[model samples]
Target: MPESTPFHDLAAFIALPRVSSLALSPDGTRLVTAVQELSSDRTRFIGALWEVDPSGERPARRLTRSGRGESAPGFLPDGTLLFLSSRPAADPGEGADDKQEAALWSLPAEGGEASQLLVRAGGIDGYATATAAARIALAAGLLPGAADAEQDERLREARRKAKVSAILHESVPVRYWDHDLGPAVPHVFGVPDAGAEPSVMVDCGARRIGGSGHIAVSPDGSLIAYTAALGTLPDEIRDAVVVVDAATGKQLRVLEAPDAEFGAAAFTPDSRHLVCVRERRITWDSPGDVTLWLADATDDQDPGRDLLPAFEQWPGAPVVSPVPGEDGTPVVWFTADEGGHAPVFRLSTGSGDIVRLTTSGAYSDVVASPDGATLYALRSAVDSPPAPVRLDAAASGQEPVTLPSPGQPAALPGSLTEVHTTAEDGTALRAWLVLPQDARPDTPAPLLLWVHGGPQTSWNAWHWRWSPWVAAAAGYAVLLPDPALSTGYGQHMHERGWAHWGGASYQDVLALTDAALRRDDLDGERTAMMGGSYGGYMANWIATHTDRFKAIVTHASLWNMYSFAQVTDFPAYWMRRQGDPLENTERYERESPHLRAANITTPMLVIHGDKDYRVPIGEGLALWNDLARFEVPAKFLYFPDEGHWITKPNNIRLWYATVLGFLAHHVLGEQWQRPDLV
Candidate 1:
């Protein structure tokens, strides 16, 4: 058989054919999941919907009974299941590509033939539709039409089927946060519920929610409030909550976000008001605060009250919570960064009184159910994986109900050890080291110090990836560090590397290496580094600054701020974070690894998606040219039809295959097939 792919690899995992979705039933007693399954013999794989009575003691039962059809499952408040199913893409396996043709289906909770709820010619994303609320909301994607690629398609197909012609008129669309089907194309809005048909209240126009967007309904059903983009992502835009007319899709008023960003806002159970978490995003220093916005439905213009400045940062802890009052007007029931812990807090919206809920050292994203009777919170930690906690939150006020892992739990290697070490500047850098189970201190196994890309991001709290997992399975130790900039800790800790690109920030990984050397489980002689985006930048930095590693793999990396400022998708953002390269030209030179290509002596494999606008592939190409000119060991890997992320199963398989082989050969000192070598 082909080499036993590790559990972490996409082929092994996606190959399992399972679905993962979170949908709550109308009564909240039943939860639905969209799962895919393979026949017992393992030849055929099927995608279908399944429901489990969270309150019952039974296995989940299948809901959808169709062909290779069904995915993106959601729950409607009235007890119906809404989902998207794979339909015939005019181009066959193009799947949900150009046609965007997945038929939206709604099936009764009791069960029956699924009915098509909404079927448009094209354009849709994971959607939101009310069960009995009479409104549906979906993101509209940018459609690529016949105006551009018809000639190429016609010529290519003419040589094949002879009859196959390019019939492309309009294709896929760019999906965004807000859209109202009533106004048609180009216009979008926040969803509304007027007891009549649902409409949009806030317009997205060309704006997008760089992350996730949530729409909230008032308990009274007379008003609607939704998270909306006030700016464009070219600037990496932030969003705000707006009060909207439930019937006309009209924006009554918009709550001005105090910080550059705000998130996951929710209304009180009574629906007369809402509370939002405000956060500034200019630097690593986050000023996390909670602000309340109110609208009485009758008072249109002055719906918002004075911004309540009630809480401050709690170090090492982050809680996700928004309270719509249990019985009275909605108060700002939230969690704060109080005394270095993210315990749940019940703060009175009217009086600003703070009450501590959970004293646990970690927790986040807490949400109370519609009736204010149940609260679901996702608890987190640096080394601890995330688990759900359901609280009565009211009387009896019982303990929390912990949620189970998504599908099957990640098969973490038994050798994994959580450790903390001191960086060059004495900052504490934490890491999760996974050594082979049989690895002995004398074995000297190769090390793969996997730097999480965010620089502002992190790899922690149950880190699972197909790439690193396979690397570990191949006899390499994977070091995952939440260096700095990783949230969970207060903003101060995350902002540790604000503008210090390769300064102290770069030394942390090396320091982590020093720490690993002290550990008997790791092999200090053979080591390699890999990461994407910001992590990619650091891989280049380490490769150039030190000749210690045997090999390196960098993906979607930014090589030069000078060129990157102009070519990247987030131009304004780079300028904001790094200061205009035009002004701080010298800093860009000092920060970029490209300036010292001659110094990098490690065997390197560079990969990039050609269509990735985030960290443009030009940076990768530039590095490849420099490495070749300097006779430094290197090769360039490119994916033509991909974005910052590789989505197509074929590309994903190919991409990881290359990295796996590269590391196996260089770091593990084992002969593995790799195109880079060829």
Candidate 2:
């Protein structure tokens, strides 16, 4: 009962005041959110640094007191805000532990107190790139959270270098839910004035510091762009889009992002174009569902130029330029769902004309009032929490500004009933199906086709996860399909695997598991399938291509794209995003079901973490050592401390109590200890 609210499909319009990052205060009159309360474990999230309302009779204002884990809010240069944290001292015991990460703070928007400024590792100053122009803040460190923890045998060899691939590991799933635990590096730094006392510039290890966000100045602020993940690794992640010189921090240009790779980014309004969502197939069951590239460069030495002439649907929780209408045109909006409810469209790149403003099945996010001419959009669903409707495109329609959900949910129930279906190629696919308030839509229940993991990351209409509200209070119905590369359905059904990755996304998830076994209360021999990284490689390639899922779990998996293209710590980004594995050797060996591990019989479990360097628990211990050397029926739950998705609430209640005893023993035969969790 963490205040109940779970369905989580992620079209992002989060409630309880979950704004997830917003900016534009440079004299637009006021609008700074980063407000938080994710309710239950991204590590107990607590953020607050809001401030909207400008005398409208009060709406937002909590400026700061988070005790730990916030993220890049950055507003400084006198409007004062800037964020990025993981710091929290003074009381400590919900402490839990995982090493933590996030430090770099600031506060003051007509508020008070908040200042630590930068602590990467404390001093050899080895960080390399950081940005934020005009008021200057640049970093290029070497000693900020720098490794080698004062020799306790080098801190147990830096904790076995947070293992994960020492032959199939599963660590990263530690817990505490916020209030600062300690050390977890995605390794960041974008200093120019991260609130002041900064220096150095550009070297996020050649190109990888821009997740969430990191410095981008430009609109007449003198070229700064800043957002990295710089490549040259196991296959090249190249999280780049750089273009510095914010007063000689140098490294003027380096864009690289071939077909589409960044996953979630923004920096447009004359920053000389830099949109970034190019996320090519990420997993944990879908986020690979975004594609909004623009990346530019006219003088910083040239290289990043996509400009998205076409294809950009679930551009991963997007929000850019939103309030500009009247013949001046800068709109370019994008909230997703174009048709199954979660609206807010705009586009108009000088007459591209996408429009669709706001339709309503709840969940919206347009946002804009720093004086761009009012545009809060916002809807938020799954029981309604984020209200705010205001709009104004220069006046034509809109008015619902209710506001007041600062993390709302004093109690909720009733409203998450949409469920649309269709997919033998009829396409229309977006399911919601949350049932189980004690089950009985005529009682055939006990189904779970639930798949999503970048399959190209697409699932809008705010459902926000709480383990599906305890799997609908342990009764279950779930469904959740947005198939066909999924992302609010547009952009050629999200590149339907552009070069093919198991034909038509594995027969559109085996035709939606035969349309939830003809849904008449759903129990088709107790079906089950799960996902994590690319929906854990489509639940271990649907257990080596179909046994009709009696159970299979898979998280952070790759099984073995030829040893994940050879030991992945990002193996050159899965060999340039699944291509050239030696010119695609027969399509990566008939769709790499871990090279067809003798065909997998099902009854599987395998969730991972051992610090998942990004899907690297040696692909969940190579499908648990080929399902226990071909005995089939497997189960391997590791965590050691966690990483890629399993954000700790007692390890997400031990990953949904081991998928509720593996879907209560393959769909209700019950009797589970491990008969694959069932």
- Model 2 ranges with Cα > 4 A deviation: 1-214, 218-225, 229-433, 436-442, 451-476, 479-533, 536-538, 541-560, 563-570, 573-592, 595-678
Best by lDDT: 1
lDDT of 1 by residue, 153-209 (tens): 344334346654333322112222122121123223334431322222333332244
Off by over 4 Å in 1: 1-10, 17-19, 36-48, 65-72, 85-98, 126-186, 189-213, 231-238, 257-259, 283-371, 375-406, 424-426, 461-467, 675-678
Reference-based lDDT, each prediction: 0.58, 0.55
Model 2, span 282-356: residue lDDT tens: 432233444455545435444443334564555344556634445564555666654444566556555556665
Cα RMSD, model 1: 7.1
State the local distance difference test value for candidate 2: 0.55
Q: Model 1, residue 320: what's the lDDT?
A: 18
Clashes of 1: 20
TM-score: model 1 vs. ground truth: 0.77
